[model samples]
Target: MNTPHTAAPVARLAAATAAIAHQKRWFARMREEVAAGAPLALVNADAPQEILRAMGIPYVVNQWWASVVSAKRMGPAALDSVAARGYPDDSLQYDAIGLGSMDLPAADVPWGGLPRPDFVIAECGADATRKVFDLWAEHPGTEFFPFERSSATTAPDNWWEIVPREWERAYAEDRLDLMTSENWQLVDFLTERTGRSFDIDRLAEVMALVNEQAEWNRRTRDLLAATRPTPVSVNDSIPAVMIPQWHRGSVWGRDAARALFQEVEQAVRDSRAVCPGERVRLMWIGRGLWFDLGLYQRFQEKYGAVFVWSMYLAIAADGYARYGDDPMRALAARFTGFTDQLYTPPLSSQWYVKEARSHGVDAVVHLVADDVPGSAFTTEALEIAGIPVLEINADNADSRGGAAAALEAAIGDFLERRVLG
Candidate 1:
């Protein structure tokens, strides 16, 4: 068995540290703003946050807050609270955790708990997503805004290449048209409710900044993909990329992306490796296991395995980045089929294969969540491309499944029998 190298404890990246600090400060400010009568919006991960940013409304992402609840070890209690309300706690836990967290006492909540938002926005994509937001809207002083999620009737194989420039051809025009109209409706809703005018030019600026940020992420991902012995861990890269992702369309977000790129570049130049004896490169596909991030690094000492790729960073590289003259339509195109690219058929499967080959992935540990679609196709595609896959069926946010121990054992078994063999 390989042993971890006796190096000084790996210092967390300054970019990641600073990003967390900034988020703490930003959250505090958001609380203060909401207290001062400024409206707060709680939006789904796929919702257009740029609209809120451009309109100057304070917003918190529902999925990010759920991760916080899960990471803080409050997920089980939160889910229990959901079940006590006669709702199915096992369903859509990732989307519903924030609502349940709202019921927790202030002392038990993470980061002093999320303040009740005036507006809750989400795309009604999944079966239970609308129901989750509906419960959120039942809270006092909160209203729910739902965007119509259209199915992908057509998606080309070269989606990554086309989505950046020729997006009109990449996604069905009808789908884009629908989301664009809904985005406008959201703009109108916010404008009417808060008296904050929607400025298309400001949204254009936000979109431009977002594209610039995506470009920086692409550079960083390419550098990490090419670097041997992986200079950064997925644990570090996830927060470093995703925290800034929730803040996308801002100058701060753009700068944070650049900072991460520079930090990674510096690490690569200095030859810093997350696992000096790394013998296996692993890709993690699905929502992060917020309850047990250490799972990502666990096999390193015994198996010389390190999780080098996650969809958080990979999607930020290829999934974002839209350039067009019409910012509204461009923004719609960016999100219209975004989830489909990650969760739909041949698109998701093809992209995972491409990503695995690009990163030289030795194996994959795909966390197959109940809510996500096309996971089997993704795993099959990777296996067909001569890569081994270990699928774990569990909720990423909820810990009720006792996943930590079982997951570790299963991954260990996979490393011994499948990957290392």
Candidate 2:
């Protein structure tokens, strides 16, 4: 299930963490600039910053939308959103409730209650997310769709290696316009009101945060992998990773990782956990549980196995950033282009193996998707490392099928064979 819990030597992740806390007032102040009467717009699940730029509207990002879908808060409401919003019951995502909340309308939900946005911008980036807005207009609310076809899988260049230029042309030309024209227009529209000053210091701060957060994530993942509880539950990590998408570029992400790192340290020092004493370590690859965190805990409880690592937040911290004289362009390079977090090659998973070895994990849960290629190759690599992997066919969010049950049984059997056989 896991190793004996041990204390980790943690380094100061980044000075930006302190800066973010100090500057939190700015984020709050930005929110205050809006008072419902202002020129604002809203989008269900779609990023308001992007669409607001497209429409020339000033609006706040959906703070509440991001929070509710976080690991700790997602529950039955997550399921309701999935089924009602027309998400593939088999797909994993967070936009259903985020976008579904949009259909509720500003007048109905109210700003005081849930930040009533002025308008909605929808994007069809993921097939599941695409349908989120289709239901929004039916609510009699005003909304706009994104240049989706071109942008959905275009961020990372690795996607082209899998799908090729023809598919990109078909998708981008037919449904979305990801050409520089749209991006230039989008930038021109927002650069004025958003008041995006090119702050080199800020770029440096974000870069430090990215590096620190990456180290912290690797450390804590190792801590979790090495230690376990009497009963391992996926819920152990739900709160730390799930809720903080807004904080991705900020220090909050590192703080969360640091706190978890300390938490597991305490657990190990006290010998207060059960999973840590066990011999099974699990690595979750791909998108995490956005809707139902309970599933994570359920598996943990059953197997004494703890999921110490995942790629979403892990890859973000690892892939994003660079220390440079010109940080704005570097920051742009990190995000505007794409790195394959999902699936194009085994190199990403090679990093995972190195991390797994550092963390001393026992196995992996490979959630395969058509969008990602060469996944099986990575799965084989993890296995060859002597960490038996369970290949699962299910979306990260949706868990309605027997696939999960079978996967669980397979995991149980795998562990049983390891521990008792």
Q: Which one wins on TM-score?
A: 1
For each candidate, give its TM-score against the true structure.
0.97, 0.62
lDDT for every model?
A: 0.90, 0.48
Q: Candidate 1 residues 184-284, lDDT tens each?
A: 99999999999999889999999999999999999998988887778888888999999999999999999999999999888776667788888899999
Stretches of candidate 1 above 4 Å error?
1-10
Weakest 10 consecutive residues of candidate 2 by summed lDDT: 162-171
Report residue 212 deviation for candidate 1 (angstroms): 0.5
Model 1 residue 417 CA deviation (Å) reads 0.9
**lDDT by residue for model 2 (203-284), tens:** 4565566556656655655555555442223444433443333344456666766765666565556555434434466677
Candidate 1 TM-score over all chains jointly? 0.97
Off by over 4 Å in 2: 1-94, 104-186, 192-212, 218-234, 241-245, 249-276, 299-303, 336-339, 369-374, 399-410, 413-421
